[model samples]
Target chain A: MGRIPWRLMFAHFRRNKLRAALTVGSVFMAVLIFGFLRTFIVGMETSLAECSANRIISASRLSLFAHMPKSLEPEITELAEGKAEITAFTWYGGIYIDSDPKHYWGRFGTHPESFKKVYGPDLILEEDAWQKWTDLRQGCIIGSDLANDENLKLGDRVHLTGNIFSGEVDLEVVGIYRSKVRSFDQKTLFFNWDYLNETSKAAGGRKDCVSTYCMLLKNAADSGPLSAKIDAAFENSPHRTMTQTERAFQAQFNSMWGNLPLFFGILGGVVLLACLMVTTNTMMLNARERIQETGVLKTLGFTKGTLLVLTLTESLLLCMFGGLLAMFIVQSVDGEILMFVIASVPPSTIWLGLGIATALGLVSGFFPARLVSRLEIVEALRRRA
Target chain B: MSDNALLRFQGVDKIYKRGDEELHVLAGLDMAVNAGEFLALMGPSGCGKSTILNLAGGLDTPDAGTVTFGGEDIGALSDAGRAGWRSRNVGFIFQAYNLIPVLTARQNVALPLLLTPLGSKARKEQAERALRIVGLGDRMEHYPNQLSGGQEQRVASARALATDPRLLLADEPTGDLDATSAKDILDLLQRLNRENGKTIVMVTHDPAAAERAHRTLKLDKGRLVHSTGAAH
Candidate 1:
């Protein structure tokens, strides 16, 4: 065996620039789609990983749309004492104060003290922000993203036209909170519960009706026993409830998308397989052109292993270039499109590009390397260039 | 011949099978070459001259009998064994010059030395020495595409001599060259045989090329029938 001539192998790729570029382009497209698909799944999971550990969501027995009676909040709080911290919130579905139709944010109505206790880790405060938030009666805490989008500062006043309550309410932005986790705190708008209860009572809507209660357990491990206790407490009540960890609660929202991860997985696989076929075809043509070169090397005393390694290295190198290109393109465009489509992109998607490129290298190179290794030196040399 | 015989072929045969049909190219061929001899093998096309060369160089195996080199039966060796032996003991010069297009003359010459256990520096030095022997010391850095056909053939000769092989096999080394380049290649082969004491087995159809050999053997249908010493 001879020393591997990497330069020699690389020269083959350099000579056919167009073919190499096309092969690499195919791989790039495949890996880019792979990255997109993977980012979607990770984005969904990240919403879970980023959810507040101190907050739990309690919903109906069958679905999130099932409501619970506001009377249960006291009993739930009594049972949660010492073992957990409890907060109650109802989805308000408030309309945006701005004229932009696309501007929508999650609005929740809750008791300020309990909400602060449950979300303390997630809150980002300005100077004297907590004092201002607790002192004002019409105070609201807005996500940093919402603040930026609507150009609202800490002292700014904003009005919401409630979709569910059907009235206009003015609230002062006393604080702006940003989540350390991805996209979690960026989309929520929090306001006082008294405003919501008063508006609903005046409108003769369901005043004692609440969508869910959020419980913060002392330990994450205690969630299983505590969830059972909460559910058992409401088992015979007029409106029975189901309590779950924040992760499972977020996952239930994912289930509404209906096997989306499996769909993306299948799409990623098909694109990669198509890319593999294109790569294999390109490599076969390249290998055919090098038949004479292979013979020359064999005649010069290069063994079968050397030829195989050289050919496969060439394929792998091409794929690596493609992978890098795909990563660059995905990193550049994914942020804007993801924020539009699914609200955020996850970092773990980078590995998807690398994995697809590696698999393409191996799968595409297999037949070409074997063909080069089995070529008869005499016959190969006799081949017309 | 007994004391100096570097290559010997005894009753060697090569048969190619295409489905049920058998094509016998070399039928029980017997030949021998001694050290320091320049032997020319001349024949018409399909006379099995190249087949004999392939057998002796360990590029192809004989179906029967034995092709031996320096007492080892090459026909009986495994593919890897044959490759190892060929790298250490045999150097080949093809009519096409066969220099790897991407590599410069120096790299092409150093190719055979790569099969040896020599380090990179040592391989370069040996390759330079071989190029100097072929009078192409200045052209070592030029790629095959940069050189003329004559220069490329000279580089091929340098590659053949790089590993200090005991036998040099040339298959129509002057076939693709002009008349002057062909003469220069023959002169190099003659010098390698006479001055360096390297065994040379060359196949050619040109009588002028054969005239440079110390002995000429004619093969007709795999049988060697006529031979003449250089003095004749």
Candidate 2:
């Protein structure tokens, strides 16, 4: 068997610059959309995956909208039976120190000791920042993005207006933390729960109330048994409790995107189908133009198999070039948009784009390659057009 | 046309069918060429002259009868087998100089030899030798687009001679050339036949071109009707 003439095949692409550009552009767009859709899906899922695995969330039996009594914290913690651990936090729903209505960051109030125990080690901090965070009474920990966005750093005093608490609270910025996990660390601001509770009591609001408790199973494998025990302990309480894995808790937030994945899947399929059509059209035109060349090859001792492989190789080369271009663009731009859109994009999304481009090349090249292989050499040679 | 016959076509017929119409292109044609003879197939357009050359070159199969090259029945062989046979025993020159546009003249000439077991270095040497034979040794590095029409056809001739095939099939080798280039190509074909003992079968509409062959056979209505030559 003769060696494949790869240079000859590439020369065909080089000779027809406009046609090659159009075909490659179609492939680039296809891969770009594929990468975009894949990144969104992976981003949403990563948000759930990045949730603290050691943290278990306890909410109301009915829904997250229902609140639990602060009095139940001790009862829930006692049910641990040395095989579980616990911490508690409340959603603060606070606006930024800046007056802009659109300036929102994740704000939560938690017991300082338990919050530090569960998350302190993972929150890679600047030197002395962790000590300052633990020592100061009015200090709040903010994400690096939040600090950068508001120009707030260590020892900067800032006032946050709580939407749910109905008052402005003065807090000193003690530390800035970046996410070890992609999702949680990027958007949160943490303050002492006692401050909010004390303020609510002074304002004659509900005193013995908190939103959620986070538990840690002693053995990761004991999550199921520990969850069942926690739920059983609070079964008949005035405010009933629901215990679930951290993943399920985060997934509740994802449910808000309802039917989005399905919509994106359908949209992605349409884009890929359009890409296939464009690729097929381009390949068909290519095959028609090279009929005489193929005939020449056939007469020069190239078998149908060789012809098929060559044509398909040419198509795959075209698509792979576009795939690389798309990959470059996505790698360059996806990080910034994703940080704003959904916080972070996963590496798997890039891999998925590459896989999709490969599959697209094969599927799209099939018909045209087959047509070239099955062509009669005499007829093809005779077909001047 | 017995044991020494290099090619034999016996009662060969090719009929092309389009929708409800039948076009009998080669109707029960029988012909034979000796080992070192140069035969010209001459006729007007649509007279199946090219078709005969195509059959003789093993580029197409006869529908009804046997077309044999070197004792092997070409019609009975598979497509790959026919291709292998053509690569080993036949070389073709087209009027338009069907050289791969990107390849240099030497690379184009080396194409048919790629089927041989020769290494790349050896293939290059043989290709250079064939180019030298066609008086294009210095022009071997030039691409088809870079060379003149006559130079391109000479490169095509060099390519045809590269495989050391016994038979050379030229389909109007000078059909796309000027008078000078056409004469150059015909003179090369005559030298290849007389000196190298290659069996040459060419299809041409030009009488001047046909006059250079060892024998000229005219086809009319899918059958060889007239022959003027020493019957060998």
Number of the top DockQ candidate: 2
RMSD of 1: 5.7
Model 2 spans > 4 angstroms off? A17-25, A46-114, A121-128, A136-183, A186-248, A320-354
Quality of model 1 by C-alpha lDDT:
0.82
The TM-score between candidate 1 and the true structure equals 0.77
lDDT of 2 by residue, B1-232 (tens): 5567889999999988999999999899988888898899998787898888888877888899999888889888888888888888888999888888868899888877778889889999999999999999999889899999999999989998998999999999999999999999999999999999999999998999999987899988898899999644
Q: What is each candidate's fraction of native interface contacts (fnat)?
A: 0.50, 0.56
Give residue A207's lDDT in candidate 2 (0 to 100): 57
Residue pairs with backbone atoms closer than 3 Å in model 1 (clashes): none
lDDT per residue, candidate 1, A1-385, as tens digits?
5588776776666767888889999999999888777776777766777776655678888668766777888888887767777777777876775646556667878878877777666667664766676777788888777787779888798787777764666789988887666635565778887887787677666466677888877787777877888899889977778888887888887788789889989988899989999999988887888899888778777888988998888899889789988877777644332532343444556666876797799779888999999998888988956
Chain A TM-score of each candidate structure, as shown: 0.73, 0.72
What CA RMSD would you report for each candidate?
5.7, 5.5
